[model samples]
Target: MLAAHFDAPGGPDNLYIKEVDRPVPKEGEVLVQVHASALNRADLLQTRGYYPPPPGASQIIGLEAAGKVVALGPGADGRWKIGDRVMALLTGGGNAQFVAVPATQLMPIPPGMTDTDAAAIPEVWLTSYQLLHFVGKVRKGETVLIHAGASGVGTAAIQLCRLAGVLPMVTAGSAEKLEFTKKLGAASGFNYKDEDFGTKCLEATKNVGADVILDCVGATHWQKNLQCLNTDGRWVVYGLMGSGEIHGDFLTLLLRKRGSLLASTLRSRSHEYKEELVKAFTEQVLPYFSPGGSIQLRPIVDSVFPFDQIADAHRRMEANKNMGKIVLQIPV
Candidate 1:
């Protein structure tokens, strides 16, 4: 088995592929021969020594993968069999050719979807779904604001909001990204680099403000995010690309708006929590990917790189040049 390895944490240049022992499945787990895996911000952070794999998880870098079930561990349910196509959310180790994941976390690839596309779905979609439904508690007819709209999670969030009949307003860095979000069902898009997105979102909603805000830009946008929320609105923060520290009258602002400020991270959660999330997502969203389902969400892949070119994939993400997920195709 070959996996991406880093001698030290720094830049993408630190990564190299090395032959490693294949992983074995544990009880209630399935061994998957990975066909494709998706790159994520967490991968970059791990490469730079900012994030480490959870306790007992594989040190290999990756958060999600699409593959075929090759074997099942003892006590695994009868629902899965050899050669079943599946995708899974991982705590780590998805960059390798083989990984052992809990059977409960495996999702069947929908008809007509390729392995590369399925590989892109698990992390971003699940995160966005959690932000929208669980944390934000978005309801139909509500207006939701999403920051970094061109990002993988952001793109998924836009589509999920549409599926729930909620209006999505997004913030992107460029005109093209804004247009891209509109096509993905955003009611309005703002160029955050050039305009005040908080004001623009309020304007788009005719001064009503957003009922929910899915934010990744953390501290830099914290004040504005609170200002853009409608009374009793929910602001869910999942990423802090800007900065984690807030240095203002944030408590007063929260009380003034009477809004809820929630923060969440999927990677650090317990296995039982992930299992519950996977189960809820499977029942509520997986059918949308089926051949004739009413919901029409799909993975938005910006580019695909071969496994050996993993460093280049990281570079693309670091540059903020990708519109959606950047994937790596694993050669069998």
Candidate 2:
């Protein structure tokens, strides 16, 4: 099997495809012949030597992939069978032709959805679902302020909020990106470059502030996050894209609002936690991805690059050029 590999910690240029021994399915795991996979910020950080794979996880970088089950490991046969088409939420090793994943983490691809689209769902959609429901415990009719509204998880969050009857607002870098988010169900979109989103969001909500805040930009968004959080609001921080440095009375403001400060990363979660989350997502959200479902939901695939062009895919994501998930088609 061929997989994406890096010789040393560095940029996208350091990535290359190399022949590696195919992994045998471990207990409770299944071997998947991957058809497509997608990029995430963690992949970037890993290649740059910032993030290392969790204990005993594959060192390969991709966090998600969609493929066919080729073989099942011990204790994995009851739920899934050989040749079942599925999408997997992986800890790593998804950037390969063959990767082994826990069978419980695999969900059957919804009818009529392409592998390319399915490849985009696992990481971003599941993360958004986890952040909004599991971590934040958001309820209907509440307003959520989401930063990075045009990225993969941001787009998924916008749609999921609308589905849950929550009002969603966003912050993006450009007017075009903001417009796109509005069409996807954002109640209000703020250009983070031109204005203080805190003030704009406050105005959008008539100074009542947000019930929950889903933030990926950390340090730069701290003060403003405090500015617009409602009393007893849940502020979930999942990523620190702007770096994790907070200045000035962080606790005082949080205490003033009685806000619950929460943080999580789906990739690093225990298998039991991920299995349950995957099951919840399968029951609650997977059906909507079908065209004939009551409320139709779609995975946003911004671009697809062949396996060899992995570096280009990384560059596009690094430049913030992708509006949604950037996919990589595994070599057949």
Instruction: List TM-scores for all candidates, in order.
Output: 0.98, 0.99
- Identify the candidate with maximal TM-score: 2
For all candidates in order, the CA lDDT equals 0.92, 0.95
Q: Which ten residues in a row have the lowest lDDT in candidate 1?
A: 289-298
Model 1 has a clash total of 0
C-alpha positional error of residue 297 in candidate 1 after TM-score superposition, expressed in Å: 1.1
Candidate 2: tens digits of C-alpha lDDT, residues 1-332: 99999999999999999999999999999999999999999999999999999999999889999999999999998999999999999999999999999998999999888899999999999999999999999999999999999999999999999889999999999998999999899999999889999999899999999999999999999999999999899999999999898889999999999999999999889999999999999999998887775677889999999999999999999999999899999977
| lDDT score for candidate 1 against the true structure | 0.92
Question: Ten consecutive residues with minimal summed lDDT in candidate 2?
Answer: 288-297
Candidate 1 per-residue lDDT over residues 96-206, each given as its tens digit: 999999998889998779999999999999999988987888889999999999999999999999889999999999999999999999889999889988888888888
Clashes of each: 0, 0
lDDT score for candidate 2 against the true structure: 0.95
